[model samples]
Target: DTAVSQTPKYLVTQMGNDKSIKCEQNLGHDTMYWYKQDSKKFLKIMFSYNNKELIINETVPNRFSPKSPDKAHLNLHINSLELGDSAVYFCASSQAVQSTDTQYFGPGTRLTVL
Candidate 1:
Protein backbone atom coordinates (compact mmCIF):
# COMPACT_ATOMS: atom_id res chain seq x y z
CA ASP A 1 0.00 0.00 0.00
CA THR A 2 1.17 3.52 -0.67
CA ALA A 3 2.08 5.21 2.57
CA VAL A 4 1.27 8.62 1.14
CA SER A 5 -0.85 9.46 -1.88
CA GLN A 6 -1.98 12.58 -3.75
CA THR A 7 -4.87 12.99 -6.15
CA PRO A 8 -4.62 14.22 -9.75
CA LYS A 9 -1.06 13.15 -10.45
CA TYR A 10 -0.99 15.87 -13.11
CA LEU A 11 -2.74 19.22 -12.97
CA VAL A 12 -2.92 21.66 -15.87
CA THR A 13 -4.72 24.96 -15.62
CA GLN A 14 -4.64 28.48 -16.89
CA MET A 15 -3.33 31.44 -15.02
CA GLY A 16 -5.74 33.08 -12.58
CA ASN A 17 -7.44 29.76 -11.99
CA ASP A 18 -7.87 28.08 -8.65
CA LYS A 19 -6.96 24.47 -7.95
CA SER A 20 -6.48 22.16 -5.05
CA ILE A 21 -4.34 19.11 -4.44
CA LYS A 22 -5.51 16.52 -1.96
CA CYS A 23 -3.11 14.49 0.11
CA GLU A 24 -3.51 11.59 2.52
CA GLN A 25 -1.10 9.51 4.50
CA ASN A 26 -1.82 6.03 5.80
CA LEU A 27 1.32 5.80 7.92
CA GLY A 28 -0.44 7.35 10.88
CA HIS A 29 2.01 10.19 11.06
CA ASP A 30 1.21 13.19 13.14
CA THR A 31 3.09 15.66 11.02
CA MET A 32 2.53 16.50 7.37
CA TYR A 33 4.23 18.98 5.07
CA TRP A 34 3.84 20.62 1.67
CA TYR A 35 6.88 21.30 -0.45
CA LYS A 36 7.14 22.96 -3.81
CA GLN A 37 9.77 22.18 -6.37
CA ASP A 38 10.28 25.02 -8.81
CA SER A 39 11.40 24.83 -12.40
CA LYS A 40 14.97 24.97 -11.20
CA LYS A 41 14.25 21.84 -9.16
CA PHE A 42 14.83 23.58 -5.87
CA LEU A 43 12.50 22.17 -3.26
CA LYS A 44 11.20 24.51 -0.62
CA ILE A 45 8.93 23.85 2.32
CA MET A 46 5.71 25.80 1.99
CA PHE A 47 3.74 24.60 4.97
CA SER A 48 3.70 22.11 7.79
CA TYR A 49 0.92 20.73 9.96
CA ASN A 50 1.18 18.75 13.14
CA ASN A 51 -1.81 17.00 14.60
CA LYS A 52 -4.12 19.24 12.56
CA GLU A 53 -2.46 22.39 13.81
CA LEU A 54 -0.54 24.81 11.66
CA ILE A 55 3.19 24.88 12.22
CA ILE A 56 6.29 25.94 10.31
CA ASN A 57 4.60 27.97 7.63
CA GLU A 58 7.25 29.26 5.27
CA THR A 59 7.38 32.53 3.34
CA VAL A 60 5.16 31.69 0.45
CA PRO A 61 2.69 33.79 -1.44
CA ASN A 62 -0.66 34.37 0.27
CA ARG A 63 -2.24 32.68 -2.74
CA PHE A 64 -1.08 29.36 -1.35
CA SER A 65 -2.88 27.78 1.56
CA PRO A 66 -2.58 24.55 3.49
CA LYS A 67 -5.52 22.88 5.13
CA SER A 68 -5.44 19.85 7.38
CA PRO A 69 -8.78 18.25 8.01
CA ASP A 70 -7.20 15.58 10.22
CA LYS A 71 -3.90 14.25 11.32
CA ALA A 72 -3.57 12.05 8.26
CA HIS A 73 -4.69 14.54 5.62
CA LEU A 74 -3.15 17.78 4.44
CA ASN A 75 -4.42 19.56 1.38
CA LEU A 76 -2.97 22.41 -0.64
CA HIS A 77 -5.17 24.99 -2.26
CA ILE A 78 -3.78 27.55 -4.64
CA ASN A 79 -5.68 30.65 -5.63
CA SER A 80 -5.11 32.79 -8.71
CA LEU A 81 -2.55 30.43 -10.03
CA GLU A 82 0.24 32.07 -11.99
CA LEU A 83 2.89 30.89 -14.37
CA GLY A 84 5.34 30.75 -11.51
CA ASP A 85 3.06 28.21 -9.83
CA SER A 86 4.03 25.59 -12.36
CA ALA A 87 6.00 22.99 -10.50
CA VAL A 88 5.79 19.71 -8.66
CA TYR A 89 4.10 19.82 -5.29
CA PHE A 90 5.02 17.12 -2.87
CA CYS A 91 3.23 15.93 0.22
CA ALA A 92 5.25 14.38 3.00
CA SER A 93 4.71 12.94 6.44
CA SER A 94 6.84 11.84 9.32
CA GLN A 95 6.29 10.38 12.76
CA ALA A 96 6.98 13.86 14.11
CA VAL A 97 8.36 17.18 12.91
CA GLN A 98 11.84 16.46 14.16
CA SER A 99 15.06 16.79 12.28
CA THR A 100 15.86 13.18 12.95
CA ASP A 101 12.50 11.89 11.81
CA THR A 102 12.37 10.16 8.46
CA GLN A 103 9.85 11.62 6.02
CA TYR A 104 7.81 9.64 3.51
CA PHE A 105 6.96 11.53 0.31
CA GLY A 106 4.09 11.09 -2.10
CA PRO A 107 4.57 10.68 -5.86
CA GLY A 108 4.01 14.44 -6.24
CA THR A 109 1.43 16.47 -8.14
CA ARG A 110 2.70 18.35 -11.14
CA LEU A 111 0.94 21.63 -11.72
CA THR A 112 1.29 23.48 -15.00
CA VAL A 113 -0.14 26.94 -15.31
CA LEU A 114 -0.54 28.14 -18.85
Candidate 2:
Protein backbone atom coordinates (compact mmCIF):
# COMPACT_ATOMS: atom_id res chain seq x y z
CA ASP A 1 0.00 0.00 0.00
CA THR A 2 1.18 3.47 -0.78
CA ALA A 3 1.88 5.70 2.20
CA VAL A 4 1.20 8.88 0.24
CA SER A 5 -0.68 9.43 -3.02
CA GLN A 6 -1.46 12.41 -5.26
CA THR A 7 -4.28 12.45 -7.76
CA PRO A 8 -3.91 13.61 -11.38
CA LYS A 9 -0.16 13.29 -11.41
CA TYR A 10 0.08 15.50 -14.48
CA LEU A 11 -1.76 18.71 -15.26
CA VAL A 12 -1.66 20.80 -18.40
CA THR A 13 -3.54 24.02 -18.72
CA GLN A 14 -3.38 27.48 -20.16
CA MET A 15 -2.30 30.51 -18.22
CA GLY A 16 -4.91 32.15 -15.97
CA ASN A 17 -6.73 28.90 -15.33
CA ASP A 18 -7.59 27.81 -11.85
CA LYS A 19 -6.84 24.30 -10.67
CA SER A 20 -6.64 22.17 -7.62
CA ILE A 21 -4.58 19.13 -6.71
CA LYS A 22 -5.36 16.57 -4.09
CA CYS A 23 -3.08 14.61 -1.78
CA GLU A 24 -3.75 11.92 0.76
CA GLN A 25 -1.61 10.00 3.24
CA ASN A 26 -2.24 6.90 5.26
CA LEU A 27 0.75 6.97 7.58
CA GLY A 28 -1.12 8.43 10.51
CA HIS A 29 1.13 11.44 10.45
CA ASP A 30 0.09 14.63 12.18
CA THR A 31 2.04 17.03 10.01
CA MET A 32 1.68 17.37 6.25
CA TYR A 33 3.31 19.72 3.77
CA TRP A 34 3.19 20.99 0.18
CA TYR A 35 6.40 21.60 -1.71
CA LYS A 36 7.08 23.01 -5.15
CA GLN A 37 10.00 22.04 -7.33
CA ASP A 38 10.95 24.58 -9.94
CA SER A 39 12.32 23.79 -13.39
CA LYS A 40 15.81 24.16 -12.01
CA LYS A 41 15.03 21.37 -9.53
CA PHE A 42 15.08 23.64 -6.49
CA LEU A 43 12.49 22.34 -4.08
CA LYS A 44 10.91 24.62 -1.51
CA ILE A 45 8.11 24.34 0.98
CA MET A 46 4.95 26.25 0.11
CA PHE A 47 2.75 25.30 2.98
CA SER A 48 2.64 23.16 6.10
CA TYR A 49 -0.29 21.85 8.06
CA ASN A 50 -0.21 20.38 11.52
CA ASN A 51 -3.42 18.66 12.51
CA LYS A 52 -5.28 20.65 9.82
CA GLU A 53 -3.98 24.07 10.80
CA LEU A 54 -2.37 26.15 8.08
CA ILE A 55 1.19 27.48 8.12
CA ILE A 56 2.00 29.41 5.01
CA ASN A 57 5.53 29.93 3.87
CA GLU A 58 6.52 33.56 3.44
CA THR A 59 7.77 33.22 -0.10
CA VAL A 60 4.67 31.65 -1.55
CA PRO A 61 2.35 33.83 -3.64
CA ASN A 62 -1.11 34.77 -2.44
CA ARG A 63 -2.54 33.13 -5.54
CA PHE A 64 -1.65 29.75 -4.13
CA SER A 65 -3.73 28.27 -1.37
CA PRO A 66 -3.36 25.11 0.64
CA LYS A 67 -6.14 23.49 2.58
CA SER A 68 -6.00 20.51 4.88
CA PRO A 69 -9.37 18.92 5.32
CA ASP A 70 -7.91 16.63 7.95
CA LYS A 71 -4.64 15.48 9.33
CA ALA A 72 -4.14 12.94 6.57
CA HIS A 73 -5.05 15.05 3.56
CA LEU A 74 -3.88 18.28 1.96
CA ASN A 75 -5.20 20.01 -1.15
CA LEU A 76 -3.71 22.85 -3.16
CA HIS A 77 -5.69 25.44 -5.07
CA ILE A 78 -4.15 27.89 -7.43
CA ASN A 79 -5.83 30.93 -8.97
CA SER A 80 -4.69 32.75 -12.09
CA LEU A 81 -2.07 30.13 -12.71
CA GLU A 82 0.93 31.54 -14.47
CA LEU A 83 3.77 30.02 -16.43
CA GLY A 84 5.98 30.63 -13.42
CA ASP A 85 3.66 28.40 -11.46
CA SER A 86 4.55 25.46 -13.62
CA ALA A 87 6.42 23.00 -11.46
CA VAL A 88 6.27 19.65 -9.77
CA TYR A 89 4.32 19.74 -6.57
CA PHE A 90 5.01 17.19 -3.88
CA CYS A 91 3.04 16.28 -0.82
CA ALA A 92 4.76 14.99 2.29
CA SER A 93 3.92 13.83 5.76
CA SER A 94 5.83 13.15 8.94
CA GLN A 95 4.99 11.80 12.34
CA ALA A 96 5.68 15.19 13.80
CA VAL A 97 7.48 18.46 13.10
CA GLN A 98 10.77 17.25 14.47
CA SER A 99 14.19 17.87 13.04
CA THR A 100 14.99 14.18 12.91
CA ASP A 101 11.67 12.83 11.66
CA THR A 102 11.60 11.20 8.26
CA GLN A 103 9.03 12.61 5.83
CA TYR A 104 7.23 10.39 3.35
CA PHE A 105 6.52 12.08 0.02
CA GLY A 106 4.01 11.53 -2.70
CA PRO A 107 4.92 10.81 -6.31
CA GLY A 108 4.42 14.44 -7.34
CA THR A 109 2.06 16.40 -9.54
CA ARG A 110 3.61 18.09 -12.52
CA LEU A 111 1.77 21.23 -13.59
CA THR A 112 2.43 22.67 -16.99
CA VAL A 113 1.00 25.93 -18.22
CA LEU A 114 0.83 26.85 -21.83
Candidate 3:
Protein backbone atom coordinates (compact mmCIF):
# COMPACT_ATOMS: atom_id res chain seq x y z
CA ASP A 1 0.00 0.00 0.00
CA THR A 2 2.68 2.44 -0.89
CA ALA A 3 2.05 5.52 -2.97
CA VAL A 4 5.68 5.92 -3.98
CA SER A 5 8.94 4.37 -2.84
CA GLN A 6 12.66 4.67 -3.59
CA THR A 7 15.31 2.13 -2.72
CA PRO A 8 18.25 3.07 -0.51
CA LYS A 9 16.52 6.23 0.69
CA TYR A 10 19.93 7.39 1.90
CA LEU A 11 22.90 6.60 -0.31
CA VAL A 12 26.45 7.22 0.82
CA THR A 13 29.13 6.70 -1.77
CA GLN A 14 32.50 7.92 -2.91
CA MET A 15 32.87 10.37 -5.76
CA GLY A 16 33.02 8.96 -9.29
CA ASN A 17 30.96 5.88 -8.44
CA ASP A 18 27.98 4.94 -10.56
CA LYS A 19 24.61 4.60 -8.88
CA SER A 20 20.94 4.30 -9.69
CA ILE A 21 17.71 5.07 -7.91
CA LYS A 22 14.46 3.29 -8.56
CA CYS A 23 11.04 4.94 -8.34
CA GLU A 24 7.47 3.69 -8.64
CA GLN A 25 3.98 5.06 -8.25
CA ASN A 26 0.73 3.17 -7.84
CA LEU A 27 -1.60 6.14 -8.05
CA GLY A 28 -2.69 5.40 -11.59
CA HIS A 29 -1.11 8.53 -12.96
CA ASP A 30 -0.46 9.06 -16.66
CA THR A 31 2.41 11.51 -16.15
CA MET A 32 5.54 11.26 -14.07
CA TYR A 33 8.48 13.54 -13.43
CA TRP A 34 11.92 13.58 -11.83
CA TYR A 35 13.09 16.51 -9.77
CA LYS A 36 16.35 17.45 -8.14
CA GLN A 37 16.44 19.43 -4.92
CA ASP A 38 19.74 21.02 -4.05
CA SER A 39 21.09 21.86 -0.59
CA LYS A 40 19.38 25.23 -0.91
CA LYS A 41 16.04 23.41 -1.21
CA PHE A 42 15.48 24.76 -4.69
CA LEU A 43 13.35 22.26 -6.59
CA LYS A 44 14.01 21.95 -10.29
CA ILE A 45 12.41 19.69 -12.83
CA MET A 46 14.94 17.43 -14.46
CA PHE A 47 12.64 15.33 -16.59
CA SER A 48 8.97 14.70 -17.25
CA TYR A 49 7.34 11.80 -19.04
CA ASN A 50 3.79 11.17 -20.05
CA ASN A 51 2.85 7.67 -21.09
CA LYS A 52 6.49 6.74 -21.69
CA GLU A 53 6.99 9.88 -23.79
CA LEU A 54 9.34 12.58 -22.63
CA ILE A 55 7.46 15.82 -22.23
CA ILE A 56 10.10 17.98 -20.62
CA ASN A 57 13.87 17.95 -20.48
CA GLU A 58 15.61 20.60 -18.43
CA THR A 59 19.20 21.61 -18.93
CA VAL A 60 21.07 19.07 -16.85
CA PRO A 61 24.36 17.29 -17.07
CA ASN A 62 24.74 14.29 -19.34
CA ARG A 63 25.78 12.22 -16.36
CA PHE A 64 22.13 12.15 -15.29
CA SER A 65 19.52 10.13 -17.10
CA PRO A 66 15.88 9.19 -16.65
CA LYS A 67 14.01 6.09 -17.71
CA SER A 68 10.32 5.37 -17.64
CA PRO A 69 9.16 1.85 -18.21
CA ASP A 70 5.55 2.92 -17.90
CA LYS A 71 3.66 5.98 -16.80
CA ALA A 72 3.61 4.58 -13.30
CA HIS A 73 7.35 4.32 -12.85
CA LEU A 74 10.33 6.56 -13.51
CA ASN A 75 13.91 5.83 -12.52
CA LEU A 76 17.06 7.91 -12.31
CA HIS A 77 20.52 6.70 -13.26
CA ILE A 78 23.76 8.51 -12.69
CA ASN A 79 27.07 7.76 -14.35
CA SER A 80 30.36 8.48 -12.65
CA LEU A 81 28.53 10.21 -9.86
CA GLU A 82 30.33 13.29 -8.66
CA LEU A 83 30.25 15.24 -5.44
CA GLY A 84 28.29 17.98 -7.20
CA ASP A 85 25.54 15.43 -7.76
CA SER A 86 25.11 15.09 -4.06
CA ALA A 87 21.54 16.14 -3.38
CA VAL A 88 18.03 14.83 -2.87
CA TYR A 89 16.38 13.26 -5.89
CA PHE A 90 12.62 13.20 -5.84
CA CYS A 91 10.15 11.28 -7.98
CA ALA A 92 6.89 13.05 -8.63
CA SER A 93 3.68 12.34 -10.54
CA SER A 94 1.21 14.68 -12.10
CA GLN A 95 -1.84 14.42 -14.32
CA ALA A 96 -0.71 17.13 -16.71
CA VAL A 97 0.75 20.58 -16.91
CA GLN A 98 -2.49 22.37 -17.64
CA SER A 99 -5.42 22.76 -15.27
CA THR A 100 -3.30 22.99 -12.17
CA ASP A 101 -1.65 19.60 -11.91
CA THR A 102 -0.22 19.25 -8.47
CA GLN A 103 2.75 16.95 -8.17
CA TYR A 104 2.89 14.32 -5.50
CA PHE A 105 6.45 13.77 -4.31
CA GLY A 106 8.03 10.71 -2.81
CA PRO A 107 9.87 10.61 0.49
CA GLY A 108 12.95 11.72 -1.47
CA THR A 109 16.24 9.89 -2.10
CA ARG A 110 19.16 11.54 -0.45
CA LEU A 111 22.51 10.99 -2.17
CA THR A 112 25.71 11.68 -0.36
CA VAL A 113 29.17 11.54 -1.94
CA LEU A 114 32.49 11.68 -0.23
Candidate 4:
Protein backbone atom coordinates (compact mmCIF):
# COMPACT_ATOMS: atom_id res chain seq x y z
CA ASP A 1 0.00 0.00 0.00
CA THR A 2 1.05 3.58 -0.56
CA ALA A 3 2.50 5.09 2.57
CA VAL A 4 1.96 8.63 1.31
CA SER A 5 -0.46 9.81 -1.35
CA GLN A 6 -1.76 12.94 -3.02
CA THR A 7 -4.93 13.61 -5.00
CA PRO A 8 -5.42 15.10 -8.47
CA LYS A 9 -2.01 13.90 -9.63
CA TYR A 10 -2.38 16.28 -12.55
CA LEU A 11 -3.99 19.70 -12.31
CA VAL A 12 -4.35 22.26 -15.08
CA THR A 13 -5.87 25.64 -14.38
CA GLN A 14 -5.81 29.22 -15.49
CA MET A 15 -4.04 31.96 -13.62
CA GLY A 16 -5.85 33.47 -10.65
CA ASN A 17 -7.68 30.24 -10.05
CA ASP A 18 -7.68 28.55 -6.69
CA LYS A 19 -6.65 24.96 -6.19
CA SER A 20 -6.06 22.48 -3.44
CA ILE A 21 -4.04 19.30 -3.23
CA LYS A 22 -4.98 16.74 -0.65
CA CYS A 23 -2.43 14.52 1.01
CA GLU A 24 -2.59 11.62 3.41
CA GLN A 25 -0.15 9.28 5.05
CA ASN A 26 -0.84 5.85 6.45
CA LEU A 27 2.59 5.11 7.87
CA GLY A 28 1.54 6.34 11.28
CA HIS A 29 4.09 9.09 11.11
CA ASP A 30 4.09 12.05 13.40
CA THR A 31 5.54 14.62 11.01
CA MET A 32 4.46 15.68 7.52
CA TYR A 33 5.95 18.12 5.06
CA TRP A 34 5.07 19.98 1.88
CA TYR A 35 7.66 20.61 -0.78
CA LYS A 36 7.51 22.36 -4.11
CA GLN A 37 9.59 21.41 -7.11
CA ASP A 38 9.91 24.23 -9.57
CA SER A 39 10.35 24.01 -13.32
CA LYS A 40 14.07 23.71 -12.75
CA LYS A 41 13.44 20.63 -10.63
CA PHE A 42 14.76 22.32 -7.54
CA LEU A 43 12.82 21.11 -4.57
CA LYS A 44 12.22 23.49 -1.69
CA ILE A 45 10.55 22.98 1.62
CA MET A 46 7.27 24.85 2.05
CA PHE A 47 5.80 23.70 5.29
CA SER A 48 6.11 21.10 8.01
CA TYR A 49 3.61 19.78 10.50
CA ASN A 50 4.32 17.63 13.52
CA ASN A 51 1.54 16.12 15.47
CA LYS A 52 -0.95 18.46 13.77
CA GLU A 53 1.08 21.49 14.76
CA LEU A 54 2.89 23.83 12.42
CA ILE A 55 6.58 23.54 13.19
CA ILE A 56 8.40 24.84 10.12
CA ASN A 57 7.10 27.26 7.54
CA GLU A 58 9.38 28.48 4.79
CA THR A 59 9.28 31.75 2.90
CA VAL A 60 6.24 30.80 0.90
CA PRO A 61 3.74 33.37 -0.24
CA ASN A 62 0.62 34.09 1.72
CA ARG A 63 -1.36 32.64 -1.14
CA PHE A 64 0.01 29.23 -0.24
CA SER A 65 -1.27 27.61 2.90
CA PRO A 66 -0.75 24.20 4.48
CA LYS A 67 -3.63 22.85 6.52
CA SER A 68 -3.27 19.87 8.79
CA PRO A 69 -6.61 18.72 10.09
CA ASP A 70 -4.95 15.79 11.82
CA LYS A 71 -1.71 13.92 12.09
CA ALA A 72 -2.49 11.76 9.09
CA HIS A 73 -3.36 14.54 6.65
CA LEU A 74 -1.83 17.73 5.38
CA ASN A 75 -3.48 19.67 2.56
CA LEU A 76 -2.08 22.43 0.41
CA HIS A 77 -4.33 25.25 -0.72
CA ILE A 78 -3.25 27.94 -3.14
CA ASN A 79 -5.18 31.13 -3.76
CA SER A 80 -4.92 33.34 -6.85
CA LEU A 81 -2.66 30.86 -8.45
CA GLU A 82 -0.14 32.24 -10.87
CA LEU A 83 2.15 30.86 -13.50
CA GLY A 84 4.87 30.68 -10.90
CA ASP A 85 2.77 28.12 -9.07
CA SER A 86 3.05 25.69 -11.92
CA ALA A 87 5.18 22.87 -10.65
CA VAL A 88 5.08 19.59 -8.83
CA TYR A 89 4.01 19.56 -5.21
CA PHE A 90 5.15 16.69 -3.07
CA CYS A 91 3.90 15.44 0.25
CA ALA A 92 6.22 13.65 2.62
CA SER A 93 6.11 12.16 6.07
CA SER A 94 8.60 10.89 8.60
CA GLN A 95 8.33 9.02 11.84
CA ALA A 96 9.51 12.13 13.57
CA VAL A 97 10.99 15.59 12.94
CA GLN A 98 14.57 14.47 12.89
CA SER A 99 17.23 14.99 10.27
CA THR A 100 18.20 11.38 10.40
CA ASP A 101 14.63 10.13 10.05
CA THR A 102 13.66 8.66 6.72
CA GLN A 103 10.91 10.48 4.86
CA TYR A 104 8.53 8.86 2.42
CA PHE A 105 7.36 10.96 -0.50
CA GLY A 106 4.11 10.85 -2.40
CA PRO A 107 3.81 10.55 -6.17
CA GLY A 108 3.51 14.32 -6.42
CA THR A 109 0.80 16.56 -7.87
CA ARG A 110 1.68 18.45 -11.03
CA LEU A 111 0.03 21.87 -11.16
CA THR A 112 -0.02 23.74 -14.45
CA VAL A 113 -1.19 27.31 -14.64
CA LEU A 114 -1.80 28.93 -17.97
**Can you rank all candidates by lDDT, best first?**
4, 1, 2, 3
Q: Local error of candidate 3 at 69, Å?
A: 1.1
Tens digit of per-residue lDDT, candidate 3, span 1-114:
878777779999999898999889888888888889987899999988888888899998989888898778898889998888889999888776554888888989999989
Model 2 residue 66 lDDT score = 88
Q: Which is the winner by TM-score between candidate 1 and candidate 2?
A: 1
Return the TM-score for each candidate structure.
Answer: 0.97, 0.95, 0.93, 0.97
lDDT score for residue 3 of model 1: 96
Q: What is the C-alpha RMSD of each candidate to the true structure, in Å?
A: 0.7, 1.0, 1.2, 0.7
- Specify the highest-lDDT model's number: 4
Once superposed on the true structure, which residue ranges of model 4 sit more than 4 Å away at CA? none
Alpha-carbon lDDT, every model: 0.95, 0.91, 0.87, 0.96
lDDT of 4 by residue, 50-109 (tens): 999999999999999899999999999999999988899999999999989999999999
Query: Per-residue CA lDDT of candidate 2, range 14-81, in tens?
Result: 99999999999999999899999977888799888889987556588899988888899999999999
- Pairs that collide in candidate 4 are none
Which 10 consecutive positions of candidate 2 have the poorest summed lDDT? 53-62
Q: Give per-residue lDDT, candidate 4, residue 5.
A: 95
lDDT of 1 at 38: 78
Better of 1 and 3 by TM-score: 1
Clash list (residue pairs), candidate 3: none
Question: 3 or 4: which has the higher lDDT?
Answer: 4
The sequence of per-residue lDDT tens digits that candidate 1 reaches over residues 10-107 is 99999999999999999999999999997788889999999999988899999998999999999999999999889999999999988799999999
Deviation in Å, model 2, residue 64 alpha carbon: 0.4
Judged by whole-model lDDT over C-alpha atoms, candidate 4 comes out at 0.96
